[model samples]
Target: MKSQRFLKFYQSESEKYHGLRYGGLYGKLFKTLHHEALSGFLVQADNSEPILEIACGTGHTTGLLVKEGFDVIACDLTPGMMQRVSEQTGDQHEKVSFVRMDAFKLPFPDACVSTVVSTRFLHLFPADEQELIITEMYRVLKPGGVVLVDFDSWVHRWCWALPFALYNLLRYQRLAPYSIYNRIGRTITMASRVGFSDIKVDGIGGAQLLLPALISGSTALKVGRMHRRSVLRLIADQFMVCGKKY
Candidate 1:
């Protein structure tokens, strides 16, 4: 199955994966952008109740939630990723529990969790699967509980589309690309249909729009850093959608 294949891939490439995605210079920049945009909402989360982090991916955001004083259940599909989370959390492991589970089928009961958060995971699936995953998150949340999720955005699709298309063509020998971009309108609509209300969305990581300069080793990093807080944030590479189940 595709799930098993991805699990093995993560297990084998865990180190390189995080290094490239969150540890490198560009990776750090991306993380800082994401953190700035999401921290406000996260800090305001109800810490008195238990939180579930689906597809936690080695506890990048899980560690943040734990440090913010939330009891976190960090769930991922790969044992290798969970092992990395154990190593990352260290003594804080007492406040964080790691579980291997599918996002489409969480093990928790309905209304058991006060908060559900996922990042950089949902956009990987097809539309139907994305809906199922969102519905699953909704199903396990308590009434009025919050669901925060991140997605790749189509706002600046023109910037990365060519590279992604070429990469897909060469790598898979097909035109199928790996990443999906969601429109803000569609994202909000999907959440409403999933029974969430008071929906809010924010854009982040506009540095990706300068991908050409970044690739050319130009002033893209400096420019991205300077303009990150400007109105250009509206055309960011990724978005976070927050909604409450009412």
Candidate 2:
């Protein structure tokens, strides 16, 4: 029932979701790291096969994939979200195939797709479910295929614990779920259990809680970029995990 509600909520929110999440300077910082991390992992994917992007809300990643000239399967549960992707990638409609399906039980054969991606999706669920989703991603990937998933970090949020609490308090958010995959160790363990080899993580989007809110956009951009490659990246707010099925 809650899952259905989430789907319905995103159904109504599809039109405004992009602006709501990626509007201001902080938003730009987040989006920049997201695009950078996803693109970096994508270039390493097997170009000969199609890419399956789960929960492709509002088509941000979908647009990027389309622009890169790969055949893409942009799967989401909400009709509105898929429609948004259609509108967003208007010029290359032929390259993107929209499918409305649940990510928990992907409707595809095993060892079929070359690349599987899920962004901003795992952090929404509990640890066990994350394992299930990762297992599913692995099952569908062809041998030597790559899977990349990016999510919000618990450690990063905890680093800004006071500000996050105050921010949520201001919005009347009294409760939230915690992600156990807060660092690379837990994430790597999950990948190994799912039979994924060559598992690695890339941290991105740091300094959100520590940086001054009034800092200029360029400065924030630098902070975000620096965290992505720096040795201190694991402490950043968001990170991407790339694993291979071989």
Candidate 3:
């Protein structure tokens, strides 16, 4: 039932999400947050290897990963999203391939990928389906392969208290049929049950206080500084969980 709901949501919103400016802004913001959250883990990664991005929307994160020299297989259930990815890639990305595949039943052979990464997509899954997807991630990864999952952590207001509250309220208006503030520890526990090791969380996307003030430059600097400090993890809006399959 939950999987069916997700499929419907993806099919309905895929085009709107990949084409609009607000969606694009959200996409870039998500990538920035993920880049901050995963910097430590990704830096430790062997860049010469290939990685799989489950539920990659419009290939935003895939583009960043590719820029860092990691080959990427970007997968999503949304055909339109995959089309947008292909448009962005434009026949030049030897390091990236976009595919349409279900996370619950990954099409890859077992132990085939060096890393499996996801961003902003887990909360879309109901509890059981989330577990199933985690299991699939584990099944597809080689021993010692890293898995990085990122999602909204409900504690987002901890950093920039005022702005986060306002932004979230506004977001609530936009991201209909979804609340976004799901349990982080429960998700972590699910990963543990799926046989993941070395589980740890990273903070992504601190507070954007000056958005109303129109201080883009200062806000960008603050975002970067907060990321460097890993300050948001102390009270992160999103949690980036890193673990190993073995």
Best TM-score among the predictions, by candidate number = 2
- Say which candidate scores most in lDDT: 2
**lDDT tens digits, residue span 1-246, model 2:** 657977877887888887766776677678777888888888888766779999988888888888777789989888887887766687897898888888889999999898998888888777788889899999999998999997677777778778767766664355343334366688888899999988778887765623643556676666677777677676888889999998
The residue ranges of model 1 lying beyond 4 angstroms of the native Cα positions read 165-177, 208-231
How far off is residue 4 in model 2, in Å?
1.0
Clash pairs of candidate 2?
none
Q: lDDT (0-100) at residue 168 of candidate 3?
A: 55
Model 1 residue 225 CA deviation in Å: 8.5
What's every prediction's RMSD, in angstroms?
Answer: 3.4, 2.2, 3.8
TM-score of 1: 0.85
Clashes of each: 0, 0, 0
* Deviation (Å) of 216 in candidate 2: 3.6
Mind sharing the TM-score for model 3? 0.78
Q: Compute the lDDT of residue 48 as modeled in candidate 2.
A: 67
In order of appearance, the predictions have TM-scores of: 0.85, 0.90, 0.78
Q: Per-residue alpha-carbon lDDT of model 1 for 1-246, expressed as tens digits?
A: 878877887788677666767886666667766766567677647889868999888777877777677888889998877777765566787898777898878998888888999988988887778889999999999887899998887866666667767867886677764567888788889889989998877767654634645565345545554444556655777888889987
Q: How would the candidate models be sorted by TM-score, starting from the highest?
A: 2, 1, 3
Cα-based lDDT for every prediction: 0.77, 0.79, 0.70
In Å, residue 50's CA in model 1 sits off its true spot by 2.3
